[model samples]
Structures are given as structure tokens and as C-alpha cells.
Target: MTATAAPPTSAPVGALSSRRLLSAIFALLGVVMAVWGSRMPAVQAAAHLGPGQLAVVLLAAAAGMVAGLQMGGRLAHRYGPARLLAGPTIIFGLSLALLGMCRTLTSLCLVAVVFGIGHGLLDVGANSAAVNLERACRRRIMSSLHCAYSLGALAGAGLAALTAWAPYHVLFATVGILTAMAAAAGLPLIQSAAHLDTPAQPDPTQHDDTPQLQPRTVWLLGFLAAACLLGEGAAADWSAVHLHTLHASEATAALAYAAYSAAMVAGRLFGDRLNARFGPTAVARAGAALAATGLGAGLLIGSATAALFGWMALGLGLSTAVPSLISAAGRGGPRAVNAVAATGYLGLLLGPAAIGALASLTTLPAALALPVLLAAVVALSAHRALDSK
Candidate 1:
């Protein structure tokens, strides 16, 4: 029942397969996001949601996400993290399909909550599993697994674009059914790996003297997660619009996010190796500093090209930040990770409104400085947060 109990020759292979399975789960979640996001307009129209009503539906989902995170954490303690992954993920996929079927605001909102819950639970489950497996393997893999998410998002977006003319219901159904079916294969492997990789007995000589993270340090970790993730949300929501204001062509404006996404994926692909070499605190600190500096120069320069490069820099700089925090918090267990993830998600929810509010009061470029400032705070605080682990 433990990896060490297996033939010595098979341990590495088992670890590799487990990591890949977990990575697939991450990618599938990304696909769910891209499909749901890209099809939102259709959902709004299909459900006949009025102006600002869509926000209500989204808010419902957000609430469910927070709830799911809490539930996932508690369940992980009872059922084990690997066993906890598939149920929520399958539910998430199914709810997504159901989302396209609802024709009224009331019905859509209900399904949205379910969709969000599934999203949140699967996120925690997979991540907690990653935390456990990472320890057993004695390596840093959260970055590579997170990159799988980015790649899946890009692929999902591309497919959504190509299938733009299809009925949203058909699209959702296909994706949902496919995901539910695939889980039969991929998720079981992840659970089995967890079972195999976990040791039945501890080495008597090794004593884990590291204390559970202090509550204050937990809040600091949450703050860092929020600050950096807010920047990511800002880029997703505002990058194209920012480019448009600078007189970039529509096509060019679209490429602004493309550049950012590409850079983020690239950075994550290399992030684990970098972390192994430089340490999380150092790599994350340097990355946050780079984001702040890059965005500041971009806005100050006031050109389309400058803005695109700036966004790219910001994306790369913040790529490893949240993953590092999650891995750190996981040291305290799933509850700690739940708090960090839930708070970080709140930042994503608040980011657009916060940016828009600031933009209304000041110039967009000036408002954008908020993330720059927060990024700087992350750079300043990375050591404090990571030191807890």
C-alpha cells in the first residue's frame, strides 16, 4: 500500500505517473474555466439575465467556491485527498453542462452555485494531493502541475473560438460528458498513487520539529496570495482594454493577453527547476519585483508595444507566486490551504470592480498602479510568508 513497499525499480515510475495524472486533473479544470468563461455571454442571453444580473449569477458561483474549499479541506482529512478529487470534479463538469440547459435566471443561478462548488472542491483536493505527493517524491512539482492548467486554458480557449458558432448547450454537454468519462481513468490513478506513495511508518530517527504555522503567518500568506492573484485577474479582465486605449488595433489588442498568457505558461514550465535552484522565497521575491517594475514602466511609457511587454512581464513575474503560497500553506494541512485559496479567489472576484472603481476616479493608467504597488508588497513580504514553512 506504500510506494516504498513496491519494487525499488518501480518507485520513480509510480511517482512520475501520479504527477502526470494530477497534472491532467489541473488541465481539465482549466478547460472547464475556459469553456464556461468564453460561453458566458451565451448563458446570459439564454437565461435572459438582465444588466448586472449576470454578476449576481457569478456571485453565486463565487460563494459556492468558498464553501467548496472549506468542504474539500474537511473531507480531505476524513477521506484522504486523492480519494476526494474525482467527486467534486465530476460534479463540476456535470453542473457546467447543466448550466447551458437552464433558461431562467433562478435556475441558472442554482446550477452556477453547484458549478462553483465543484470547481472549488476539485481545486483543493488536487492541490492537497500534490502537496502530499511532492513530499513523498522529495521534489518541487507544483509549478509544472500548475502549468498544465495554463496550457489547458489556452487549448480550451482555442477550441471555444473555433466552435463559436455551436450551441452553447451542445458545447457544454460534450465537454462535461467527456470529462466525466475521462475521470474514470485519470482520477483513479491519482488516488492509487497517493495510496502507494504514502508510507505506513515514519523513520524513527526523523522528528518533524517544524511547528504548524502561526495564525498571523497564515494571514500573511493569504495576503500575498491575494495581492499577486489580483494582478492576474487584472490582466485577464483589463489587459485588452488597456491596449485598446493606447490605439492598438483590435487584433493587436487581443494579442496583449496572448503575450501575457504565453509568458505565464513559459515561466511556470521552468518554475519548479528554478525553485529547486534559487529557493521559493528568492524566486518569488524576484518575480514580484519584476512585475511591479515592468508594469510601472509600461504605463509610464504610454505605448501599445510597451503595454504588451509590460503585461507579459507581469504574467511571468507572478506565475509562481500563488503556487508557492499554496505549497507553503499545505505544510499546515488542507485547512490552511483552503484559507489561502479562498482568500486568493476573493481577490480575483474583487479585482475587476476594484480596478473599475479606481479607473472611474482616476486615469486607467493611474489606477493600474494599484497592482504595481501590491506586487511590490508581495516582493517585500515573500520572505515573511515563506519563512513560516
Candidate 2:
């Protein structure tokens, strides 16, 4: 095969350029997701929707995301990652503006579906691209790439907070238009650094979803991913509520998630080096163990302050697991990435609901044990599950 790209240290520089471009995409995606999330309260008020109604809208978007992930995997396999990204990236960008324009439940649901599809497509496409880029550079770049995404999300949330006074429509539309233009400008540079791995011609009759890794490995990796991400889903949905239940003030309750998120960003920022030095299997195992033990103790204690530290421990411990797993999945091929990511995303989608349902049956704190248990399982199983080589 021809050299698709270059290593970071031994580069003619094109691979480095591609890596930077991919980081930008990752960052932009983080910003988009964070901004949308920050404005959910505004959207809910504007559309006059209740909690259940809001759940329905969120579910609609999730359904669309699932569809996009399936399609994106096949497309990335067939088209090469750069080509796979072009359509979805643009769709992702423009769909944001539509989100601003909707005012009714029906309209909002429709827009949410579109937005979710774009988000899902971009998610797989970008990760697939980053994996290939990492391989080209012959280094552990996945964590650093993910760090850009975390930083982007922080930036987006800050932007939304600062612009809280603006109308939702204006805020969404303006950000959407600017990002869409950025997509237009960025696409050509991304496309120029071609990184095709498949043979130029393929047997049309061959099954298209075939992946490079053993089926067992893919599924197990998927399980690890699901387990790790479940903790994240729990933190996003329940940390504040859990704190609120402890009778913490509103401001303090908010800090529970903030601590988690900030610690996650901090962990990811250093993840590449840790992975490079200790290897992915070790990192995953250690991270999972830390999450399980730390968060487990936090739940057992009565103090909200301790809970915040527990979430921080959870965030830091789990921060590198997905990136490490995704990178491993990438070595298995795009179709492997597809299978593993879908399984993981499905877990993320289901995790919060599972916690909520369990909470109804038991106390919320007890239900929170689900993630801790999963993290413990991951800690036990990580080395066997991860394909580090």
C-alpha cells in the first residue's frame, strides 16, 4: 500500500496537518453537543414541554443517532474516512440552525431527529478518521484527540453561559451558521490528505460489514466500552440529582457534575502519555479500578462534598477508557469500529434509563451502585477485553 500519511516525528508534515484537522472536527463536535445541552432548559420552556415530553424529544434524537451510526460505519468502510465525513459534517453543521427554528413539540422533535443524525454520523466518522490518523502517525494520539473534544465542550458551555441573555433562536442560528462555514472550509483540507486503507477495487459480492478482528474481540471490546460509558452516562444524568437528594444547595449540586467534567478533561489531557508509557490495557484496568473504588466509597458516604470527590474520581478513572478502547477497535478496522461503537452507544443510551428504573425499585443511591458495579467489572475484565497490540 502507498503511504497514506506520515508519522508525527518523521513527517513530511501532511499527516500532522491531517491530525490537526481531525482535532478541529473533534473540538467542533464537542462544542456543538455542549451548546445544545446547555440550552435545553430554554428549549423546554419555549416549546412548553414537560419532563416526559422532553424525554420523548430526546428519545427521537437518540433513535436518529442510532440510525446514523449504522449507516456511517458502512459508508466509512466503503468510501474512506475523509469521504465518509464530508456529507455528515455538513449535515451536522446545518442541522444546528434548524434546531433553533423549531418552537412546537412536533417541529422540535423533527429538528432534534435531524440534529441527532448529524451528531451520530459525525461521531463515528470522526473517530474512524482519528483512528486511521493515529495509525498513520504510529503513536498513541487518541487521548490527545479526545482531549481537544473535551476542551471544545468546555469552551462551548462557557460560550452558552455567556450568551444566556440571547434568544435561543439567535444563539443556535448564529453558532450553526459559523460552524457550517467552518465545515465548508475544513472539508477540502481534510479530503486532500487521503487515507484510504481498502483496496482501490473491491469484490462487489463480498459481505460489506466484515471487520478485521475476531468477532469475540469486537463484542468484548464493545462490552468494555459500554461499561465505561455507562459510568459517564450516569454522571451526566444523575450526579446533580443525587447531590440534590442529599439536600445540597443548588450551587453545590451543580458543582458535582462540574467536578466530574473538569476532572475528565484533566485526565484526558494527560491520557496520551499514560497510554504511551504504560500501554492501553494497563491504563484501562487502573482507570476502571479507580472509578469503581472511589465512586463506590462516595456513594456509601452521606456527604455531598464527598460525592463530588467521588464523581471526580469517577471522571478521572474512566476518562481514558473509551479512547483506549476505540483506538484498539480502530486497529481492528472501520467495520470493527462500527460494531463496537454501536454497542457502546446503545449502552450509553440505555444506562440512565436503567439507573432510573432501578432507583424506582430501590433508593437512588443504591441504584447508583449499578455504575460502580459495572466499573468494577470493567476493572476486572479490561486486560482480557482490550486488544492492546
* Candidate 2 per-residue lDDT over residues 204-274, each given as its tens digit: 55443544567788888999899888888899889999999999999999888778889999999899999
Deviating ranges (above 4 Å) for candidate 1: 1-13, 195-211
RMSD of every candidate to native, in Å, equals 3.2, 3.4
TM-score quality measure for candidate 2: 0.93
Each prediction's total of clashing residue pairs, residues at least 3 apart in sequence or on different chains, is: 1, 0
Q: Pick the candidate with the highest lDDT.
A: 1
lDDT for residue 226 in candidate 1, whole number 0-100? 91
Tell me how far candidate 2 lies from the true structure as C-alpha RMSD in angstroms: 3.4
Query: Per-residue lDDT tens digits of candidate 1, residues 1-389?
Result: 11223332333447888877888899999998998988889888887887689999999999889889889877775677786677887898889889878998888889989998998899888887887777666678889989999999888888888899999899999998788778866655765674322423344454432326787888899988999888988998899999999999999999987788889999999999999999999999999999999988999999999999999999999999888999898766677777888888878889878998999999899889989999999999999999874
Clashing pairs in 2: none
Worst 10 residues of 2 by lDDT: 195-204
Error of 1 at 319 (Å): 0.9
Question: Candidate 2: lDDT of 57?
Answer: 91
For every model shown, what is its TM-score relative to the native structure? Answer: 0.93, 0.93
